[model samples]
Target chain A: MNMPVSQEKKKIFVTVGTTQFDELVTRVLHPDMLEIMEAQGYTHLIIQIGRGPEPQIPTSQRIQITVYHLKESISSDIKDASLVISHAGAGSCLEVLHAHKPLIVVVNQKLMGNHQLELAEKLHSERHVVMCYPETLKTTMTVFNTSSLENLPINNQMALSNYIEKLMGF
Target chain B: MGSGGHTGEMVRLLSTLDFRHFSPRLYLVARTDDMSAKRVQQLESSHISTAGLFQTVSISRSREVHQSWITTIVSFLQSTLECLRILFYYQPDLILCNGPGTCVPPCIIALLLRVLWIKRSTVIFIESICRVNTLSLTGKLMVCFLADRSIVQWPELHAKYPQTVFLGRLV
Candidate 1:
């Protein structure tokens, strides 16, 4: 009934914009492991559409595919989506957390030059989001991205918000 | 001195430069005060005059909506406007841009006032930043259609944007 949700399909938005996602979806220890994600009871996946290289999930009658691009749409789409799997951008991480959705952060190492590894590691320590490193993505992605967001901590987000507000005087 | 081809690269180089030679005043802008001040302090203490502009949107875990598109827009606009104001006040001879969205607006202002108008101010780009193409969609848009003198780290990037001058390796 709300805007942005087209239908009631079990959609999982796994953004493969940054190189981090490219590496994860492309380099499976089992090259055919995309079947696992398809069979994981997902009705569809919305990936970030880009020129040339992008994530490839088997598209068929049963499994539908959609891609969301444009930096402007990020805040809106991230809010509308049921679940978010995205890069470990400070803004993205903060937005996903603000939405109170459990986030699976895939860091783009090649682009970030290992900076995201540091961001993800620091945030993971704070229990903010799940980190999916390229080396351990296959093994850890399943368990790490269970999408159980019931355990929401209202305190930290509010506290951080308050701190930022006080500092900004807005 | 800086990394990448645009403002971030400039931030890195101008940061390392002997601003003490001129005691240049500076202003740093960001989306929120969430970013720690250590980096800002270091740049300032190195003889560059400095100040910051940031305001954050409230995000609580229990709130009905998680992401505020409105807040994000406001934050961007405010940071951009503040960056413009910083330009009017500091009037630095050069502006160093890092890849952050906060820097884009001011860089654009600098471009209009300096580059387009042919003001003598320098706008140097950092060569060792995260390449925008492979970054989040927003990251790419943040640097759209800007940057005057780009000090690109990779020879490949120089070919990607022929306008970017291929400076030597970033330190």
Candidate 2:
């Protein structure tokens, strides 16, 4: 069944969040992946490759993939995204979750220590995000359709807000 | 604020703040941190009435994860002086900071002010949710000596640092 033209154009924002994750970038920009993304209705793939060499992907007529070396603000990209594919950085994860965007968090194993992996596991267990390793990304993407991702529970800031309010004695 | 995830978490925590009560807010970022500054500006533009309510200051980082000790000491001294200048000018009632090496200078300045009986700004530190087993370098140093209140997002962290409050995940 063909979906409406308006509904067919989805935007996917890919970011490595300050550090280099060349592995993930290479995986995403693979021709097979691009073809799959296009088939799945992604019209735009906005990639923020932080501190990493530019990804080499041939321009496709079907999917408009834009790559940036680094961006000062990705809020606009996040806001425009139908899905967010990101490194397991707390900032990126929180931003995507806060925006209520469907997210696939790829853990960068090269990072020093287990913090990133722990965070990814925690969020994955909570069903807040889909987590995958760089090597498993292709298979993960194949099995994991965007429709399977549930809308994340809205983060409740009121607890902290009220706590701060009382701390300020206001 | 530190760049990347630290900035994002700080923004979330700040978002919950009653800006009416926390007027004339002073936001500090590392000199090279275009990302954090931009994120803070975006937050300010959306929620607050006008940009005039808050100010952004860019200071230097004391140390990178891997840097020479001499460079660290020099940067620390420079950043400390910068923090002192800002503290004197602002004299804020409360200083809210998350885990970042950049936070150390201002926090030290705040502690010194309290010791000198010059100023008494409550210094609150929130450890990043990313920290699961061990405290970040900044958290380990600040919680024991400086911060008036330190919070952890994970129960395990709070268990490890029993003094720090466990408020659950900020994200």
Candidate 3:
């Protein structure tokens, strides 16, 4: 079943967390990729660029794309988004998951350690998110479709709360 | 809280606390760490009915990635003083933190308070799930002496640090 027109018009939020993922940002902003997103019915794209230098975004009268430098709060943006394309930062992943949005995690291999890839692999194995390498982002987005987003398991808050209660000896 | 991944893990762990029992919780974050503070506020508003139940204070960050030792030392001293002041005023019964350089000062100060018989706040240090094979620098420091209870997400780490409890992944 197709989503209602209003729901389909919801923006896609692309965030790199506090660090820059220039490669991912570049792929996302590519005219061809943006066209695919536009075809998918995303009317607007909101990107949190973090420390990455601003990419030359192609002008599209059809889809409105806004770039933010580094936001202290992107919760509202996350909430408003139908899909989230984020870096493999656990913070960004968790926030996207908690919001119950469809997520695509792009790992930055240039990081000091390959830890981000480890996390991406784990989450991908769990079917919690789709994982893509930074270099392969364009190909991933080219084939991107909404049906790829499986329904996430319930938020981990209740289980975490229960555990904390037990730990606190309550 | 530090920033990025550590803050995310900390937020998930904090979400599980029975806030009714742990009333008036205080969150200590780095002075420039807007991300952590925003996250804590969001979590509280979503879960808890009480408006003022969660309070946040910004303290100095102990170090930055790839920063020099001299910069780290200066930041650590400043953060340590801030931690002492916050602990003295708030006087929380239990202090819970995850792996982050920012967490070190508070954990150390809490230990000092307990040793000096000033205040006996239990410090619980949870190693981040990202540390699959080994503990982070902050985790190594706290797991040995400062933290009353040190928890690890991965069993391999638990084997390495037998004393630290292994609970499954919180995130």
Candidate 4:
């Protein structure tokens, strides 16, 4: 049977940057979760698994899956993504937010101090990214819409430049 | 700088610099952290006009994640000595750091140099953007005495500290 013409290629990119969160990789690939994504009209799932074991993909019917360990840079992948699911590292979160993509930040609760949770929660309050634990990722995905989110402030990264210039008397 | 988020943020911050004025830059990473060295190189080649305008120096991490307190003393002293050597050799005009354990020793050395009227290397420390409600241990130390200019990314931190400059998302 021919696929419906209305079905377009929508890719969901899941990244755990520079650190392994095996639980996220496992949870997102669970058949139930795949069905959720399929129901939501996503056609592809690309995962960047950082220092983790290669994920086992169940024999699939509809959605396509791709996995890789790392990349020199992930900005291109992020740019191509329809929605991004990322670990709650500041680097990954900032990259996605700066790209203005809809994001779901999965907090790695196993880590000590849980500063990642703090960052995710703060962003969630601002409606910039949705925050969920690995255990809740399925439910979060089932309800998540890639349509609406707030914009981050136009990057003030240049402010640091001016401050450094002033300090150095340049 | 340390690896992971620390290096990522520092690289982003450094990329904002006008390399013409800040040429001959020095990046100090944990001696074992090859990843950060690679990142610094990437940032330099992409952002700077010339190669060899920047140099990277490797030093031991003053405190590693989950390191025990007893061994921390030894590692901290070792890193402190290394930072002293590096600073004395370079006597750089400015020292910029974020909240990595590797940064503490250099900040201390910079403060000592300033207090002794030997070198006036202005030290600036930025708290990680992750710190929303509370400061990291290194952040508290910088606020207490180390930094000449302390910056925080979140407005809540500035409201709590009052002393830190809130510049709103520096990296």
Candidate 5:
């Protein structure tokens, strides 16, 4: 008899667009770990998907990357991803969660010089997106092999009701 | 301050300034056609005067429009006429313009009708985004341009326009 492989099958997709916030989080993920990620048969990896800003660092060949600006353009890609990493801007988070994809969100503090940190923290507390702050990023990525979108918080029914309330009042 | 950086920050700064020493009537103009101004009003309801023109038109012949010369001509005429009506009525002591292209005509009127009753009526042009880059472009022509003081959110603007003063980020 054989044991199941230690790593779960993985498909990862990343996005940081619509706001200039991605630069901070994008700085951290090194291009080297695709071996550890790929060896375990983590099937796919998608990174840095946004059109506005170009990457400051070089990219890794182990994973695929797409810089998508419009929400409609990202549908099939998110469906193919197991985990979605992104900046904590409201619009991007809505798109990730709309697909019921697992998420790790990083907010951009340097660009607009405003309250994106607060917005990120609020999302993490609400269980909508996992916080990818400076310290937690490493642990979060290592565990990426095991994580599944099924366990992460994605409440379309609840989100739709909340979105409707926000719309009706406006 | 209606919902953006320059306008939002300016409202807070004005609250702290010694306005008690000088009488100033600050009117927050809204473009009924624009959403940013509406969000701004919601953010700072207590701080600004809500009355101003409700119509707005863009500074484009058309974006992604294959053909619209007829529509563009009609909008240009309508915007010009409405602006004339606003300038004659508001006569604000100080015009603080944080924009949408809607502010253009009223501001042009403010400069054109310089009254001797006041040594100078203060008009401040505030820029946060590059939506209408016209304000920066105009500094080349007028010695003391559209607004008596031009306030920009980006510090880089100060270097570009010697007349501009940089205000810190709008929340």
Candidate 6:
């Protein structure tokens, strides 16, 4: 008689939001990073490449990998993810934080305005997310700890509605 | 509403509204943005109570990313004319927009209409949550003269610009 072993599936979802961040995409798809992610016990890797170049898979990887260009909404992906590694876009960060999942925000310095850097740094300082530059992404991933993360409060949607109603005299 | 970030936040904000009170919502999208239209449909359909109460209109983009200054003037003027036509026809009671380059022309037109005794449409501008320390170009331009009320999601921005109201992360 043999005992059945239950296998757990852990997924890491990487998103670059609507804008292209080729550096973050390329760095995440590197074989070395794949090895690191696998070693960290992530059984599945999903990448939302956005407008970046298509990913090419290396033949020798044991973990499962899925890549797609874009989606109407990434809420389901964020829900399924055990960990989310995303670009420092405000929308993506807020969505992940709203889900109360562990998040690693990788800043794209090549972006023209570079407002993402400030946003990411602020969130990191507040301990809501782990912020790192694309160059340091690998190191950050290797040392990432989910228990250190904190969830941001759900926003009061009524506040804006009430204010607008009062201003509009409704 | 303009780019994906702006559209996403606006949709989330509007989802909280009482559609019956704020009926006939008009969403102005940038000509270059196709995603926002689909998002609008999703938002409308999800709330069956507000079906057919809101619609989206496409306006020329005021400026494209990395556009040169000289060509920006031409596009800006083109968009301003389009906004003028739209606002003249609708004359909405309230115009709500977050910071996006596409919002600038419409807000300016709304302000012009109110000043000229044409029709009063209150314009509200909400700064993007991404702006932590400083204001975006659109925020700077609208804070003083364009918007009837300017709101910021971050205390830092509200403190720096006393003109902006802090609603504590509306988006």
Task: Tell me, by TM-score, which candidate is best.
Answer: 6
Cα lDDT tens digits, model 1, B95-120, are 55545445566666776667556454
Residue B71 of model 6: what lDDT?
Answer: 94
The CAPRI classification for model 5 reads as: incorrect
* Top-DockQ structure, candidate number: 4
Please give, for residues B55-158, the per-residue lDDT of candidate 2 as tens digits.
89999988777779989999999999999999988998989888888999999999889899999998888888888767888898878988988888887788
**Per-residue C-alpha lDDT of model 1 across residues A95-164, encoded as one tens digit per residue:** 5676776677777666634554654565565566777766766565566554443432432113222322
**Residue A152 in model 6: shift from native, Å?**
0.7
Per-residue lDDT tens digits of candidate 6, residues B25-108? Answer: 898998878898888888888863684467789988989999999999999999999999999999999988888889999988
DockQ of each: 0.02, 0.54, 0.35, 0.81, 0.04, 0.77
* Per-residue accuracy of model 3 over A55-99 as CA lDDT, tens digit each: 887865578889987876789999999889999887788778878
Candidate that beats the other on TM-score, 2 or 5, i.e. the better one: 2
Model 5 misplacement above 4 A: A1-9, A19-29, A32-36, A48-72, A144-170, B1-56, B59-171
Highest-lDDT candidate: 4
**Regions of candidate 2 where Cα sits further than 4 Å from its true position:** A1-7, A35-44, A59-64, A70-82, A145-151, B49-53
Where is the poorest 10-residue window by lDDT in model 6 chain A?
A51-60
Give me the runs in candidate 6 sitting further than 4 Å from their true place: A1-6
Total clashing residue pairs per candidate?
20, 1, 1, 0, 6, 0
Query: What's the DockQ of model 3?
Result: 0.35
Question: Mind giving the per-residue lDDT tens digits that candidate 5 earns over B1-171?
Answer: 332333433444443423332233434343432344443344344434433333322332111123366875676456556655555554555655554344455566666666534223456665633311233333332225566656554445556666766544322
Clashes of 1: 20
The digit string of per-residue lDDT tens for model 3 on B14-133 reads 766667778888988888788778888788887654534668999988887887999889989999999899998888888888878888888888888888999988788888766766
Docking class of 1: incorrect
Better model by TM-score, 5 or 6?
6
Cα lDDT of model 6 by residue, A53-74, tens digit: 8877676897888999998779
